[model samples]
Target: MADKEPEALKIRREIGLVGGVALVSGTMIGSGIFMSPQFVMAYVGSPGASLVIWALSGVVAMFAALSYTELGTVIPESGGDFIYILRIYGPCPAFFAAVTFILVVKPFSIAAMAISIAEYAMAPFYPGCQPPELAVKCTAAVMIVVVATVNILNVRLAVRVQVIFLVAKVIALTVIVIGGMVEISQSSAIIVENLNVENSFKGTHYSVSALGMGFFQGLWSYAGWYNLNHVTEELKRPEVNLPRALLIAIFLVTGLYLLVNVSYLTVMTPKELMSSNAVAVTWGNKVFGSWGWIMSVAAALSAFGSLNGTFFSGGRVCFVAAREGHMPDILSMAHVHRLTPSPALIFTTAVSLVVLIPGDFQSIVNFFSFTAWFFYAITLSGLLYLKIKKPELPRPYSVPIILPILVLIVAVFLVLAPIIDDPQIEYLYVTLFILSGAVVYVPFIHYKLCPGLLTKLTTFLQLFLEVAPAEKNL
Candidate 1:
């Protein structure tokens, strides 16, 4: 087998407009919706402000997407922010972003999503009992393998899987909205009075800094709006389709999220919202009577889709990073028959499995929410650099200069909010983790101290593994 010729591989451009939309929306609609409301309400201390922060987060995401359009369209590369930052800033910033994503953000996010999937999947069977912790971790580990296997086999099949879950999740959200509407109509007087009364916003714990922190927390629910951009190379008609899919997905998610929040508010007060860990399930029990278990299934499916999408896009960042010589070369190798980044998928899945043992979902969320926006701020800053440095570059899509500026401001605030609200050592630890990539890069790539060993390893990899044509650095 080692003597067998390596299979030729390249990312197939088969993902269409609908697939693109599904990817973006599927990645964004994770356990965040079910889990984030409580945290946001806790921070903001009111249902009204919680709803407002969600809306504002959506708007910020939309603007960020619009700013990203120019880069995704004009460059049309595989790595999203990695490529953008590389183009504008240099190799160092891009390497840091890729390392942070592959090492910390992506795997932690996947583990959290997988754990949520397992929690919802086991919820009905356990009833009043807490689901076994080992069972949850094992189930999540299995899901990580399943998703990785699907992507390793074929890209189209992976997208198809995403679309199926995406549709199921959408239908589930629609049902919840319809249920909320019915409840509102039946008790219009009470619901209307609850919504209109000024007391709704009169929580004693309201903190301005906490509201900023909450906005960032809610933004986590809207985090993966940029997933499609990560796979631009596989997207059909990326120039025209990328922007359309992004805008549609953002608007769709924003609307669904707002309606879902209103639905929760209609059935439960602000106090109840903060108290319930599973907001959707709570709403379902109140609204659907005996059929409430359906919501648990829906939550599982929602997290499943997000987990799959995370594997689909997150691996590409590592693949691109490796292809550019920032990491091990083996990860850049694509599958011969399927053209998938199989090595990258396997590496990402392995990390997720390791992280599953901890199963601390909220800690994962806090770490990711803080780090992801830091990259966003850096990417937007790079966009500003590109506009000034490469003024003559052809842009297929463009946003007002102010749009990127606005997002950058918000990103900076969100990135700093956690430390400002209540200073923590985790922020410093994450910073060291990100900067640690530089330690590897300096010895491995910049100095090229072990060129022969690295060459032999990459050659050995190619003997058994297929790879696409070497990708060029931006």
Candidate 2:
């Protein structure tokens, strides 16, 4: 008689279709929708042009998500574009993807959401003036900790929290939509008069710089469309739900965003929106009177959900990279009993807290989009390469050949257009930083540098954290 072998630990497939939708749409509905409309309006210079940017941004997001469906299904793994790039392009490109995501894109994005949450949460207390910078930063850091704690505690608990906040944020947006529709129905609606054809497109900006910035800001609202891909292994049925979640989530968000923007314009003129620090609160004041603080509370909840979704997905990138030999072994481990990637999630939270100190919501979005789209273009290019070179690879879900091509074109425009219009030395530095990943990748990742130190660190962390190395789900 032989003793039964101990079962290997793996991330449970606790996320289902509804959870997937919540992760994507709830995350997409985050601080961006609450805050980005004004920035987009500022960049485009008119309600009409801003609306165009929003619609175009939605289209681009949908195309990109659909293209990701192809890759997500084919790879059937977590880690999002990092896994796709690794499979098709190789480890070097994959290493760069991991570095940017773990260091810049995900952390900057989480920081942005945290700041939004903090600003909204602290708004009611501050009254007329902007909250003190230190208070806001401290609040944001606390929020990052809370969200990280929830995620690190239990995966199922985190997903449940996501779904709850998704409902809260959706109800909040619905109130705005209903309020605006009522206003639109009234013949005396000043907002309707403002949207009259002549006024709607008034003072539209046609400059390339303006359009690029507008798209960047607008697209940030749709940033989480591919988030479910990052936790694909935790999904119950990846094939059926991956594309379905993307379609439903993205389409719903597109409609909600358009209506939400209309609602904002109905409440505030472009100048008013641009000048305002908190757009949703202002609209809520007009719509909800002294109860505008309720919107502030709602915005905080919305951003909190967005932060959790980003935290949940972003940590998996680190875990997956480590599991695939791209990162340190500690990151690839799960808590012995909890089964959550606590170490990786904590690592992500620490970086985001640092990012929150000096980075505001707007600047972070600008930088996040620059690095994000650069990797996206490469990841989608990998999809094209997979389609051509590995024709026999099983693709349970697939988009047209032209989909990734069109997305690549848009991605290239997004990466190049803004800087060409007005070159930023920051963007140049960002490029250098991205390229510099190779320096570490070659030595540490390729040559396995300093194995002894890393091994000691991994052993100590594993014991202290009560984590064991995790097995891949599939």
In terms of TM-score, which candidate is strongest? 2
lDDT per residue as tens, model 1, 1-474: 469864445567888999999999999988888778888988888777788889999999999999998878767788888888887778878888888888888998899898888888887777655588899888889889999999898988999999999999999889888988999988865456546767667673555468666876798899788898788888888889999999999999999999988888888877777887677777888888788788989999999998999899999988888877777888888876677888888889888788778757777888887898899899888888778788888998888889999999998888887788787898899988898888887887788788888789878876776655444322
Per-residue lDDT value at 106 in model 1: 90
TM-score of 1: 0.94
Candidate 2: tens digits of C-alpha lDDT, residues 291-376 = 99999999999999999999999999999999999989999999999999988998998888888878878889999999999999
Instruction: Give the CA lDDT, 0 to 100, for residue 464 in model 2.
Output: 98
Point out where model 1 deviates above 4 Å: 1-8, 204-208, 464-474
Q: What RMSD value applies to candidate 2?
A: 1.4
Q: Which ten residues in a row have the lowest lDDT in candidate 1?
A: 465-474
Clashes of 1: 0
Q: Which has the greatest lDDT?
A: 2
Which ranges of candidate 2 are over 4 A from the true structure? 1-7, 186-188
